[model samples]
Target: MADDFNSQRATLSCFEENKPVFDSFKVNIGKGGLGHGLGEVEFAHSPLEPLKQEGDNKAPIGVFTLDAVFGYEEDIKIKMPYLYATKDLICVDDSESSFYNQILKTPKVMPKSFEEMRRDDAQYELGIVVGHNKEQIRKAGSCIFLHVESSEDAPTAGCTSMKLEDIQKIVSWLDKSKNPILIQITKSQKDEVLKLYPMLKLEE
Candidate 1:
């Protein structure tokens, strides 16, 4: 009899400033409390500056919890709770607004200083919410997510983007019961991770 929680945990890691166009990430599955490399994905920016502010365009370098999975499809299947981003759904980025960094479904009426979750482009066709700065820390960044890349070589606005197929695989691979977490790292933090958890493998 084995505990499923410890075995199913997944870690998504990325190195700081790894690439000029897009950063690379590796997704691994935890087995017997050790991380087994599952596959690789691309993220944007190594994030030189802190990610606690808007317009940084730098992906946060730290561990964040996977909150929710969203897609435009009506019946998309995934390991976590899924939501369909309607045309009226938006995430408030206004630091002053009480709803800052919060997603709201406001049908028929558009709000100012908000980001529409539903977009004409396919970049957000499917996205996974990253619980970064979830406390709504003013000016500490907002609307961070793991989503699809518009172009294979283009960078994202402080988000981890991947190919549609890859994102789908990641969403499917996640296990909610395991408390799956994403540990986005940088060059500086690499040694710390390796020192703390040698079981986790890092690939170039």
Candidate 2:
């Protein structure tokens, strides 16, 4: 987790059957920091903290499912369901549209606002769909994913990002049958998170 709600960088670790699968790695989060999101569990946030919004640029804080894998490639060898991010594929971000927070092919439905799944940069070359706000809550947050970082290793608009090799490793390791999930939170919320998921061995 980040040191605080305002931090854009944090350490990420992977585990399998309560054993470390790989050494902890660094990752870049939302440029605007972190905020409460719709996830597997709800967390109590201070009045000062903000809830995730459509364009807040804040990474969601809570447990979320790793729904699928997406990339610019036509096909991938990953075990999870893969999405080929074709030129026509877009993720709707328009809260007013019926397809809010959904990924769809263009021309079939046009929303006022949406993000192209296929990008010119390498950021979207490989990515994982994070199951945040699956209920399509208006302005709650949308199109969240675990994707490759930019060339500069800069922060994302809201998605979590890491080195291409690192993200690829994660994507390859993920198994749909395992029902993989992501737990994201600040250090201050560690104790509470432990109470809910005691199996986690988070560092002090």
Candidate 3:
């Protein structure tokens, strides 16, 4: 978890059946830090911290499913459901549009605003879709993912990012049958988070 809401970096650990998959690695989060988001577990809104909103640059804080794997490639070897990010593919962020939070082929349904899945950068060359605000919660944040970091290792708009190799490793290791989920929270909220997910045990 991040040190706090304003933090841009955090240590990420992977486990399968409670067994460590690898040593923890560092990852970059949203530039604005973490904010409460719609997820498997609900957190009480704190006046001190903000709730997740579109373009907030805050990574959502809670448990979320790893829905799918997407890339610019036509096909990938990963087991998760794969999506080819064609040049015309876009993830709609315009809350007012019917396609809000949905990834669709361009021109078929044009939203006022959207993010191109196929980018000139390598960051979107490989990515895993994070099921944040899956219910299409308007302005509650959208298009979250675990993707490759920028060349500068900079923080993302709201997605989690890391070294390309690290992201590749994670993508290869993920199994849809296992129902993998990401649990993100600050250190201070560890105990509370564990209580909600009794099966999860973090190192002291």
Best by lDDT: 2
Backbone clashes in model 2: 0
Model 1: number of backbone collisions = 1
lDDT of 3 by residue, 95-178 (tens): 988888887788664789999999988989899988889889888988999998995458989999999899889999999988
Q: TM-score for each prediction? A: 0.73, 0.97, 0.95
Query: Where does candidate 3 stray beyond 4 Å?
Result: none
Per-residue lDDT of 24 in model 2: 92
The C-alpha RMSD of each candidate to the native structure, in angstroms, is 11.4, 1.1, 1.4
Cα lDDT tens digits for candidate 1, 5-114: 23222234433223222233433221222211111222233444233357655555556778888888876766688878988788887888788788878735444588
Quick one: ranking by TM-score, best first?
2, 3, 1
**Top-TM-score structure, candidate number:** 2
lDDT of candidates 1 onward, in order: 0.61, 0.91, 0.87
Off by over 4 Å in 1: 1-51, 107-111
Q: Which pairs, if any, clash in model 2?
A: none
Q: Model 3, residue 115: what's the lDDT?
A: 94
Question: Which digits, one per residue and each the tens of the lDDT, describe model 2 over residues 177-196?
Answer: 99999989899889889898
